[model samples]
Target: MAASETPLRLSDRAGAQAFVQNLLAVMSELESALGRESDGVRAGRIAEAMTGAAAKADLAAAYTTGLETAKANAIALARFAPEGLEALKTAQRRFAAVLETNQQVLATARTVSEELIKALAEEVGKAHTPTVYGRPSHSPSPYGRAGANSGPLILSRSL
Candidate 1:
């Protein structure tokens, strides 16, 4: 059989558990960051900041979950493989690669999210800004004072 195909000996259960525990810890951190982001958004100020935080949190959470799943699958392979050692090693490498890919994706997501939020905030601010013929006014409507034209107009006729 090719060396690549040969199975590897399985590591101790304790080692697998340790790896899993580490993955869970990472996941927990990601969750905490996401929670903070949500809270910031709920506060309703500093929208751009909130969006950036939320995006970071989202990407982190996704990466953590993905890496956790990959680790779990690797552990299962270690348990079931007939050629234990080789299979375990292969699984471990595969899981590591997955983790790396997830990290890259997370980073990209964070960047994109931040930019999107900033652009949205800018657009909203522009849309809501008051327009004035003279000095700026805080009135809701730009055209004139509220109820100014509510009364009927009087007309004078000259023969």
Candidate 2:
């Protein structure tokens, strides 16, 4: 069998408890950060959302590390304290729900931003398009002739 497929050895009961506690702590922090981010986006406070980005990233990393440690020690944990394992499972379910909500909020914000940019681009194109001159008193096209031949609009998405 490949080394990667090999199972990790079970940790002692005390170590298992510590690992579970640490995972719970990181998960709590992650949940808080996600809540703040969701509220900021809902309120249209870009600055508030940006402020939590770094913290969220850090907490997410820590949570992942803790989960991996717990998995390696799962056998020991099950033998030592089944109750602690059940609590961790419950916390995981709660975290998943919050994560789903946060994702929906972020998706909405992105769609709104994209629509606003497209509207702005169209307006800018119309304004910059040159008017075509007509012979005598003939009326020009509602959209300037130049507008029809304008280059494709390019949007810069640095955000």
Best candidate, TM-score: 2
Worst 10 residues of 1 by lDDT: 150-159
Candidate 1's displacement at residue 127, Å, is: 12
Candidate 1: regions farther than 4 A off:
1-10, 47-159
lDDT of 1 by residue, 1-159 (tens): 235643333366655455555544555555455455444434433354355565565666655554544455665535644354364345556556555554555566568667876787666555554558854335555775643423433333221
lDDT (tens digit, per residue) of candidate 2 on 55-157: 8888998887677767777778899767889989999999999999999999999999989988988787766566557322323567655345556777664
- Computed on alpha carbons, the lDDT of every model, listed in order, comes to 0.51, 0.79
Consecutive 10-residue window with the lowest summed lDDT within model 2? 131-140
TM-score per candidate, chains pooled: 0.33, 0.75
Per-candidate total of colliding backbone pairs: 7, 0
